[model samples]
Target: MKDFKVGHEIGKGKYGRVHLATNKSSGYIVALKILLKQELKHDKLLRQLEREVEIQGNLNHPNILKLYGYFQDEKRVVMILEWASLGTLYAQLKRQMRFVEKQASRYIAQIAKSLKYVHERHIVHRDLKPENLLIDKQGVLKLADFGWATYVQDFTKQVKLNISLKTNGYNTHNTHYSHFKYSSSLKTICGTLDYLAPEMVKRQSYNEKVDVWALGIICYELLVGVPPFESIGFPLTIQRIVLDEVMIPDYVSKEARDIIIMLLQKDPINRPSMEQVLNHPWIRMYNKSSPQNSTQTKLTKTIITNINYNNC
Candidate 1:
């Protein structure tokens, strides 16, 4: 941390600020996340930071940002991560009203693959949105921000380690499965309002299917230029999510509509698994060389042209 020279502030969050930093040791540029120790002492936020670092460290994929290292001093905790030069997917999408089907598919496919990997390991990324998806200089989409994630087994394991005391002031066998059950249920409500699953809005029991619902929202937004359930305000949006209200604009393609329908199912049990999603017709169309290459060429030109015009 001492060797690194912190540059301009890139982003800010409630808990901390992210700075573009140069690692003097390796001469590598990285996004350094610095959080104050007083902020972490809150217990809830500290646990979140630990979970994010732990999960991100374990995950290694081309579509996931790499974590370099972390150091903590008396005042702050610093985490170094791969610097994505091109900014966020949200910014890129905002610049271009909506992405063509081929362009959206490539990015969604990469995210689905990453989610599939994380889900298989029993990790549920409670937060997945365009803002959390970063674009590298090479135009690859990477899944970032694991601060809201949790391990399914870790909760159970922690419960087992703590025993309940008897009423007679003696140690007794813990019958606290109900406690863990409630705790697990609460975590589902920890996701963002715009991208939260139906079950998450209802504060009911859910699992990895929640991520699929968010991905579905991301896909819909990609196709139609706005989230299907989003309204003019946060309250209205929350109401729609809780009430299972969604609107699909006529401009959205049938292929995209079908995929969205399957993913946005009210019942988490009925939603398509990540693997099934990967092989879905809409996704399969993106894998073909002809369509993929053609779309990439068109998008690359469009992006370059827009950048040049803006520079002028």
Candidate 2:
């Protein structure tokens, strides 16, 4: 604690706040997530707090927020984290409204890679939203917030691929990283309802694909400046998620629209995994902007001024 000096508060939440902190000896900057132990104790969230700290501490990926280290004083727990110099994706979205499809494609593909890494390790990031995604100085996307995350072992016992669709297109389950789910038909609803999958809202057994469902919503929102199931009230939003079709705008490219449908499937079992999502055509668009293929480039003759003719 003595080695790090806290700066301005960067964010505040229900139980804690994020701050800019600098390491005194190395002069490295980091975001410190500080939680008052007393507050957690009073709320009886001690176990969840420990789990969050532990989860963040164990993750290691370039596109995942790095939890450098952590320690606890008598009063609080301090977490050292990667400082996203460009702030959050939510702030960026607010200013820009919606990103051009190309930019959004690049960003989401990076997130997919991060998801692939974590899912491979059986960690389910139950809470994934724009506010939890941070961008670094180089415009790289990183996933943050592990408060709602749980290991597949904690909830799932075995892989289940059976899912049934409604006569009018509704309830079902499919496999996307369906290798595991919470044991004993996992129970518990968490995270914001806006991005929650239908199965989650229906309180059915779910797995990592719920994260993919949220990814689909985020992809749509990134293109349209709003969520697919926009509503004026909470119940309305929940109703939409459970009953409404995922409608993509006409302006969206066909490739991007298809990926959204694949992701936001009514059945959790039908959604694509992060690995499959990244391989989809929409994500492939990220590599289409070649400098040689752009209007910005023009072929021109080059003359060498500094070269000696004798050397040639």
Candidate 3:
């Protein structure tokens, strides 16, 4: 492990850098995410790192990143994960301009299935966007980066608080007021602004539904080559999300628009659940018409080429 060859710096984030490394013993290529120990000293960041490992470890789906193992020295924490040779979905989309409806549907369905598993396990992946999704050489999508995810049980409890005070000269007696208690609201705004749900924009209490909203945005982007609510800046973007300002491009198929609208509903309660999304008419039709043979052939060739290249 100490003498492992680091080929290239594949990615970097707030926590640390990710490198393509080859394990000498097993002769396997792995994506190594290195986090700075100093940064992890902060309670909040440490919790996020721990949660990422926990959530990723629990997810066994093909659409989610596979966590192999982790190690820590005095300076850094190194996490070994599945290597997706093709790189991020964002780069792929950028290269292709946009994806066909059938392709988009297949990828989105896989992502929905991943989210369904996460939600069922009482974990919310607060940040899910193209940048966080990786495509392997096989063209399979793997959801990555769980820095903003949190356990549902840890966030579902309501807290009660009462305040008593005497205000001004007019108030001679103690006045007590009780704040209405709801589920523990996530306070940190840790996602890309463009994909945030309406409830998230308002800083309201949210759950797994937020991930649905993000998927909708991803769908829209895959169809229109950009997000549905693409604004000039953060303030304008937040304003648009808060105002429910969204439009389905004319080029987008009617079925795709319908799915997007359902997922991007202003009310989180009204948004389609992951199961409903999977069963949606648009998804069903797309799945039926998917070019399985073509996709499979391309994927096989790509994976074989990458593996052979690595061997060389």
Candidate 4:
């Protein structure tokens, strides 16, 4: 603990708060996530915390937040994390309402790249939302919060793909309509309410495709200012997610709308992989200005280069 000096509190979470800190010798700025060990133990989340550290520590990517290291004492667990000066994407959304198609596409592309890297390693980031996304000083997006993440040793060894829309009810024991063998699939119902995939809502075993489903919801939220399936109540929200068709505004570009539709397919099998999402036409042309905005290129560049990281 003597190796770093802690400063002002920057954020808070379910079990802890994060503070700005600096390494004593290196003078490197970092975020100190201080978790109360007693609270973690009381909630029986010790293993979950360890898993988060293990999973995030091993991941290396420009678009993924870095977990530098951690230490613990009798009362607290302190994690050293890279400092994202610009705060969370959620905060940005609250301020800007919604992002332009070009900006949203670029952000989505960065997330897709990061997810592809994680998925390729057989890991599933079960919880992905704007709140879990941070922006660095360079205006780059970084995926954070891996507490619900898990590593699957054999994601490809799943034995079945039979999913029936007419199933009497959602039953993992019903092999006649099971999408994947329960033994080889993840069955834990997790993730944010609005971002839950259809399979997750059905209590069916799922895989990394759940993350892909979340990507679609996030993309829609970025462009439309709210989740596609969001409703007034919990039950209604779940129903909407399972049965409602997403309605993109006519103002959204065709390419952006097409990607969102492809990503939000009711069937997980029909949803494109992270790699496919990254390679989609919208992502490929994220830097191109829309026909309606002749000055968008300059405006975008200015927004990127002149970000007031400290204020954000």
Highest lDDT: which candidate?
4
Candidate 2 residue-wise lDDT, 151-222, digit = tens: 776553333222222223343234322333344244568888888888888888888888899999899989
Q: In model 3, where is the ten-residue run with the lowest total lDDT?
A: 157-166
lDDT of each: 0.74, 0.74, 0.75, 0.78
TM-score of each: 0.81, 0.82, 0.82, 0.82
Candidate 1 accuracy as TM-score:
0.81
Pairs that clash in candidate 3 = none
Q: What's model 4's lDDT at 81?
A: 81
- lDDT tens digits, residues 32-140, model 4? 8988755764323765676677678788777888776676544567777877889999999999999998889988988998899998988889999999999887787
Off by over 4 Å in 1: 154-188, 232-235, 289-312
Error of 2 at 46 (Å): 1.3
What stretches of model 4 exceed 4 Å from their correct place?
154-183, 287-312
Candidate 4 similarity to native, TM-score: 0.82
lDDT of 2 at 184: 29
Error of 3 at 218 (Å): 0.6
**Tens-digit lDDT track of model 1 for 73-116:** 44667777777888889999999999999899888898898899
Model 3 TM-score is: 0.82
Question: Candidate 2 has which clashing residue pairs, if any?
Answer: 155-182, 155-183, 156-181, 156-182, 156-183, 173-269, 174-269, 174-270, 175-269
